[model samples]
Target: MTTVERTQVFLLPDLGEGLSEAEIVEWRVAVGDIVTVDQTVVEVETAKAVVDVPCPYAGRVVALHGAAGEIRPVGQPLITIAPLDGDGGAGDEPAGHATYREEERAGSGNVLIGYGTGHGGSGRRRRRPRLAVAGEPPAAVGTGAVAQTDPTGPADAAPAGTGVTASPGSSPALVISPIVRRLAKERGVDLASVRGTGLGGVIRRADVEAALADAAAPAARLAAVPDAPEAHVGLAPAGDGDVVIPLTGIRKAIADKLSRSRREIPEVTIWVDVDATALLETRAAINAATPDAPVSILALLARICLSGLRKYPQLNAHVDTEGQRIVQSAGVHLGIAAQTDRGLLVPVLRDAQRLTTRELAAELAATTAAARAGTLPPARLTGGTFTLNNYGVFGVDGSTPIINHPEAALLGVGRIVDKPWVVDGQLAVRKVTQLSLTFDHRVCDGGVAGGFLRHVADCVEQPALLVANV
Candidate 1:
């Protein structure tokens, strides 16, 4: 019996939560390897979390579209697979076309965005909208092709160089990725002048970088001339020995978020030093009673925070700038700020108010560990109502950290150390720690913020206050 096989292209699925792109961290499979349906093929890092992307089709891998560390937009081809027949022979139909038909019939499973198995709902996949350039016609549908038009007449097209193929026409330069456009804009490079070497004449990030490098020499020469304008003087180029690192992945995400917070939120910080001796003693006593389940200082502080939020619900809310309202959360989703090698990650414990002290401790410890290991899903990394930052673990006295964006407040704990304290009019050594609350001024004034911090301090100073309140 004759057998035939056709190649199927797997586009990168929507990694969830409206994420547009992901950086490829590692590829688990290579060309010529047979991958089963739902088999993990590549690991990608989005702005929110690291994810293991599974292949929806079972077949022999024909191609891997991206290298590790490359950022691929969603809906871009990720992997190409050739499905094998029962006799292990190739299919009669063309490699690419037959796969699309098969995809329509069998569906690409529930993992991808556009196509899904017919368990429920429509099986048709949605396509990403194409970015239209000047003089370009509306993009053709259902075909993975970009419409390119040269601004200069085709007869006057310039010779291709450095990945740029300039042609004479009335259309603007063909650029795809927004990252490329942003880079060009920031560097003052004219996109209309730079040609695209990417598929279908799309200008890519590399092309913009090349343009920037080519312009650097002439700009420097012009600046070196005597009596020359000092406009670009302060912009020092990197030295040969200097290691210039590009901000990408988690670092870029952090920069964008913190920048947005600074730009939008009107934040205020207030701090107080608390005697944590009683809190420590209470933890030790509880741990001694339940040796199997030891509660951490962070968990105790988290419990204190939950109580404070209950009293001052204003701080437990975020500002909806679009609606011009303070949107308070119904439940406490506690975000624990954890520093990881990848960057700063905040893994949240959902409905934290519902958990007991021991349960909070377990979840906090596990979530933090998973965050540092880069194993937590994207869902676990977002939707936090408030953030808890234990900067004390770094042995620091205090910090005024930026509030995690959208969240109304962040509680920062400094290092706990022995300090002189007055007990019953006598001075004695006690465990002292600084607690700082940075809150959004738009949510509440200093009155509410101070009340919340003071309540937290009261709990730390006298554990009985928390017990009584509970």
Candidate 2:
């Protein structure tokens, strides 16, 4: 007697916000384990945020489509879940393995924008049928093959070249996902590069990704591209005497953004020295009176930035060079430059215009703390109309900061220290700091840019100008 069971493949849902791909940080379930609808099955990290992907179907976990740490694009199969029973189980077992049957492509009645589901609910659903060759054994179905059971694993222990070996006589690596194949093919990777890391030597998406990364490494790409410039740009292959660090993950993201900013934006910086004596005293007085929650220098600077933006709204905007447009924002989404263990991350405070000094301080503290802990969501890292960078924490006096792309301007504040100033026609020591503004010339001219910086300086010099408003 032949018994048939049906399974459903859950594609990774659009985690919202136009993100295309996410890395599989971890999986919460295993094969043969029961799961219910809306269960958190996996944690994925996109370019902007780390999100928990939920299982939309209730069934037994038949297979995990990708391994942990593998990057999967949108609409890719994340997991395969099968219905519990055709007749509630408790029946005679089949000989070796039940013939895997095909299922329709109707998603769990759940999907994100632009991929499978669309308007009118009539979007053509694409079915993915992962099947075993006719007469082929299905023992490898949903098999969670352990990584090379070596006496030689990828583990720290064990000598190299002593791990599990796939003899040429064995069947080609049991691959179930088309994504894995497509990835390898796109990168011109040989599927036989090594044994698959999946069940029964079934290759996982991670294996293919690793192959693609290895092929794209600087050492490997030397023969593919002209090497003269890259060598000067630190792209040369490492020698025995050299320790080469590859740009990857967050570092790679930073490199790409900085390069694009430097290449596309024609930037110019203007600086002014401000006597911060009054501002310092005002902040101290406020803190001394409150003692509960103190306003930060960043918060004060942010308040002044918003005020300055109000007078010169053009600086708080984005430049759409492709459209030949200067887009001015109605409100400020203030990005505070934060240096964290992960790297330099700019977390935006949405609609910062309406926030009071205390509230701004709280938000800045929270945002910076979250960034340091690497817990800030990806969405919070983007969409800024202006940026306030306090380089004083780094013990620097000023910087010609690169403008955060799309945004037209960045305000940099330097360390406030005792500096000689002419007061009442006499040389006096005063608390002074440097303020610099880097802007895209397309947005505004020097007259407007200078005015904005002058307004900030005026507020910093006469704290009452800003403190009263706060």
Candidate 3:
């Protein structure tokens, strides 16, 4: 008796915080593998972080949507799963259900990183499922070139488990979807006989259905034709001194962010040299007095930033060009630019203005630790109104740092070193550092920017000024 088997696709999900696409880092399960709900089927690397995506449906994997290293967009099929077959319900008895339809109707109730099999849930609204070929995977769709397509159907289409490698000077068979291949195989039809209408001659489900109707005809029109000119990459010899490295993962994210910041923001930079001798001495005194609970230079600087922001709130605000308004946030959601082992990361601190120096130091330590460990959640990486970049840690004397986008200004602190200074007409050495403030001109003019930088420099030169302000 002929019966219909149902197939469903598990799509690539929005991981968190509105990520669009992710690279297939590794596949935990393979085709023909049986998987239970909540099983991690694949590990993918989003632009900012790596995440393990769990399967929300329990079924047998019929096909993998893409191979490793391919970047797949959300809502695209990640895997095709065939539910247990049933006279009415295939694995009903084991599933504690009456039929396959019942099991599918019940659904996996749990929501994962924006993915769930449930029809009704509080999670993100599920996307409408697009129908695809019952057997063909997205990768098998087309090679994007006519040269890679087989105009003639050959048994060369690799079956499951046998590595399908096209012979030299011959392109790989375009048949990838098992459904399409199975239909042709069962009907005793040659795939090469069918003329492909898919992109660059990739066969589709409609092609298979059309082939079945004209059984009495000579051959299916969608089949690949005779051997065509092969497309192969010309590679340089092993000793080619320079190697090309692809920008991906965190690196790609940084590149995109920086490029966008430069393109959109009309940035201007203003810098000043400050005598940090008082700041250093102040830190030493506080450390010596506190002994165990010593304060950090960053903590003092953070205090000064909050104080300066109160005086000049414009620099602490963001320009919403689209809205044609400046968003002046009351609480400083401060972002600290930290260079971690993974890459440059800016972890945000919510309501940083309310924290004390000691408290700010602790929060900074925790955020930096989380950033370096790559355990900082997506929430910790966004929503900052201002940024404090300590480029001095890199041992640089000065730098014109790019302003973090959305935020109007970024404060950059340079390496503090002993330098020649005129102290009351006497030439002497004093600890000094260069401070730079890169700001969006649309948000504020040079006067506002200069006022903010000078205020920070004043606090550095005279710590007593911050104490009085506090």
What are the lDDT figures for the candidates, one per model? Answer: 0.73, 0.67, 0.68
- Candidate 2: segments with Cα more than 4 A from true spot: 1-5, 16-18, 85-241, 467-470
Find the candidate with the highest TM-score and give its number. 1
The C-alpha stretches of model 1 lying farther than 4 A from their native spots are: 1-5, 91-108, 112-240
Candidate that beats the other on lDDT, 2 or 3, i.e. the better one = 3
Q: Residue 45 of model 2: what lDDT?
A: 67
Using all chains and alpha carbons, the TM-scores for the candidates as numbered come to 0.71, 0.68, 0.65
lDDT of 2 by residue, 27-50 (tens): 555444455545556666666555
Evaluate residue 38 in candidate 3 and report its C-alpha lDDT on the 0 to 100 scale: 57
The candidate that wins on lDDT is: 1
* TM-score, cand. 2 vs. native: 0.68
Q: After superposition, how far is residue 173 of candidate 2 from its true place, in Å?
A: 28
Lowest lDDT sum, 10 consecutive residues, model 3, at: 231-240
RMSD vs true structure, all candidates? 12.4, 11.2, 14.4
